[model samples]
Target: MPAQPDLRSSEPQRGGLSATQQALDAQTALLPYALAVFTVSLPAYVWAGSHAPNAVWMSATFAIFAAAWAAFYGAVNWLKKPEAATDLKMRGRVQIFCALIWALAVGQIAFFADGAGAAREPLLLTAVAAAVVVIFFASPWLPSLLIVGPAAAAGPLIALFAQPETRELASLSWGAIALSMALALIFNRVLRRQFEMAAERETLIADRAGMVEAARRLAQSKSDLVATLSHEIRNGLTGVAHVLAAAAGRNGRGAPSREQLSAALDAANDLISVLNTTLDSETAEAGRLSVEARPFDAVNLLRDLVLLNRPNATAKGLELALHVSDDLASAKTGAALADAHRARQILANLIGNAVKFTVRGRVEARIEQTLSGRIAIEIADTGPGLAAEEMERAFEPFLRVERTSAGTSGAGLGLSLSRQLARLMGGDLTAHSAVGVGSCFRLELPYDPEATAEREVVQAEVSTTPDPADRKALRVLIAEDDGLNAAMLRAVLEQLGHHVVHAVDGRRAFELAKAIEFDLIMIDGRMPNMDGPQTIAAIRALTGHGGQPPIIAVIGGDAEEAMDCTAAGADAVLRKPVSVGAVARAVADAISAGRSEPENRVVA
Candidate 1:
């Protein structure tokens, strides 16, 4: 037969039981003692009444038992109080006192058997048996065995010692005492095992509950992700469809202009940007998003953002204004260290949402430095303000508020992502509004006044724009796996008067570069056969290669991917789906920089 499993190894320690359960067990184990004291006193009173010769002695003994019983009952009630349950010292004292009382009662029974002769031997033995039963049920196992075991044996032994003729009764009493002791030991082991099992069961239940809660949260997160994704996809597709339909209408009437085509392309790019932002938000939620701290002009950044959204505001027939406080203007230097790109993204989201929701009145941006040397950018809008309940849940992801006016709908990630980005910069975003009143969203962030002067000196020599006359047409090689992206790059490059060649994969691009002398090589970070880095390494390894033709890496909007490409010898990196202007600028910079210094690589 197989050996039984050891329960002691698997169960929690005996002391691991909860405080409430331990108190309850202690109460349960002591209850029988409380009742036994009162019940056992009745026989003593009856014996004192029947035996007149020793009435005073019996009465005194009965009185003493009654007093002890009263004290014991009072102690039990005292211990039941909530505060008393935690008093270990008091509980120990009470247990000891009760044991003494039990011993004294056994002594009284033995005395009666001796004084009443052999006639009371049977009665005395019966009293001893009753005491043993009470002890077993009333007290914990260890105490019961120590106090009652000897008491049971002592009763009959004393009777036999006083009356030698009662030998048979004494012998039977000894057998009963031994049996009682064995039962007590078995009961203790069982009671301890049961308590341990109860503790283990409680722990298992708690762990199961925690797991259920975790699963519930995971399910909710997935549901939110699905809903947000669907909403965003539908909105993006709808915008693209509208743009295409408008362009088609213009084409049928006469001919669609360059502006019409540009508008359609811009709409498509905006959709891609939205998808990228959603991905970035998910990365932030997973605690994997990285923030870059660099010096930037906060005042100019805010002005550009406001200017960019001015067209949208104008189309809505609403006034858009920028208000910089006197203190900020006087400070002269607006440079601060922060994740400027992320900060701009957050501000843009707020301003865009404000412009979209407000049909009339004005949208205003206010920039100021607080007394604590922190920058505060507040965007206030005269839109249909949010209700109290709506404001409470305004920053919750995927939760969209119903507006009274008609406007473009979104996946409701803008505010949530904005708030997270703001907090990530050691600041916060807060909103205050009432129904029918204008709403204000404030973003506060830490600032460094000392960086401003140095930033101004640096900015003095930097050129914001490149001279168009200096732009040169060059032979550009494009290696991309996506057909649409490849076509777009070719068109954008050709429009700028640059000769273009397309390669379907990294290996094919490497083959093309070897066959022809191209001015610049543009490779996608991910492709078939070889990736961007592998292709870059292979090209650089060519014999007599002088790094003459700079390599440009086109990748998704992941910072890590961009960095990887730069580390792998790419001259520059442009995130997709990039604009025509962005691609043109990158190509021009790569060519110009290569001409100035043949070995130089520009990392963007």
Candidate 2:
């Protein structure tokens, strides 16, 4: 078996070939050398025709045409590659093609020189022919045999019948013919071997690419299978979780044993996690992960990450710290885009492993400016470092070295997902580690200065004393699809003392909007027959509902999906697993904002 690669470290390939370009460059290098050695009488360019009438009019045409054919053959060889070849080699092939044509072109210009054709004809033709014959026998070709074989059998007859110089001179011509044939025969065999070697090298390269492509397709197929199964499982689990909770609630607490209930809940949570991660892996592999770029404070985002991970890090006895580098202001451009959740995942994975592996030593996160003006985020852990072999295999999917803490394990898709996410956002992940020495993982990303300014979301302070004005009942319209989920939601809304009216889906939601006046519309993001956003847009198109309902999107997807709802006229968005208090607050706000001045409609 081949040795496993150290994925954690990639000393980015020398010429920056992202796998595709390197292939083309390899073939380009061979074209020029092939062209130079095949110089002939007639030639012009890679896509152009030959020099002049005189140059190709003679037998020298055969030599020039051979060189031209080789250049075309070499070029097509490179073009079929998966990636474009880069740098000097790409240009060199064209140069050699042009130079060969230029050499033939000079022969044409010499046609105009006085007495040149007569004086140069015998010497130049013979000299060039001698070189060709020498090179042929020295490095012969398959086709050269036809030219050499016949010349050997006809030499003596030609001298005696045609030339008739001195008898001695005829004998010399015969000998010259024999020598030429001997050399050409030997050279053709050598040429045959050289061509075979080149062909083998080409075949090897092609086979390697085929393997890589097959691996890619196999990976894609696996991701699709995971995604399909995850979706099917999740649809089942959503109903199961809610039904179990409802059943447990109605069971008077003691019907099912506490241990049994607890075990069930734990299994549900684990399944949910597996489903979410599988979805992430599948979407990421398909390159379907989309980002919603909104302005949000960089420092605040960092603080949120630290706060969000605080509970887990604390439970693991890990030291988690957040630091901000001041140089993020330098990456000034609308050109830069980073998915905040992706960054969080990338960082969380690094920090999570750091804390999980380090038994007693510290895990620290340090933020600093990268040399390239991008943000450099590092998570370092003082744990047992990896062996040289293990280091390379760390980031590869489904690979775990077993050098870390016993329970610190995952499907191995996490780091691969993390790295690809970083690259998609114009950043890269790299790690530095030595045997017995701690490891440092670094992520460099383009920082957008404007995102911090645009996303200003700070929770408003809540007063301890409830005001009489806050007691107002609000009119709410629930647009949900699943009958069971809707019932669960209505119970929560009705308990909060809000008047609730329900719609089956987007079509019914639109009908409900057209017929009656409501303070708020709790619209489901994904609904058959027009969807939530479409329903909201239809409502917005009409003049008034007496008071315009502030539509809150009950989203089934992530924040990026929520952004699309907001753009389509939703006032706010909440995910499907929204808690009771969150729904009540949304209802309260929408009602207060959309209420008529003095209409007392049981108005909370």
Cα lDDT for residue 203, model 1?
78
RMSD per model, one decimal: 8.5, 14.2
TM, every model? 0.67, 0.56
Which whole-number lDDT from 0 to 100 does residue 135 have in model 1? 52
Model 2, residue 298: what's the lDDT? Answer: 47
Q: Report lDDT (Cα) of residue 375, candidate 1.
A: 87
Worst ten in a row by lDDT for model 2: 595-604
lDDT of 1 at 99: 52
Number of clashes recorded per candidate: 0, 23
Tens digits of per-residue lDDT, candidate 1, 1-604, equal 1122221234443335643344345644666655674486577546533553565766775677677677767766776678655654445455555555656666675666566533366556655575566556543435444554565456546766565667777777666766776786787767666666677777788778878987897688668878767765677676567667666785356545677676656666566656777777788877888776666788877887887888779988999999998877788565656777778888888888889888789999999888888889999999889887888677887677766433554556778888888888887899998777779999998888767522211111111334447657778899999999999889878777789999999999998888788889999999989999888878777655334588888987677777777777777777677565577667765666653443322222
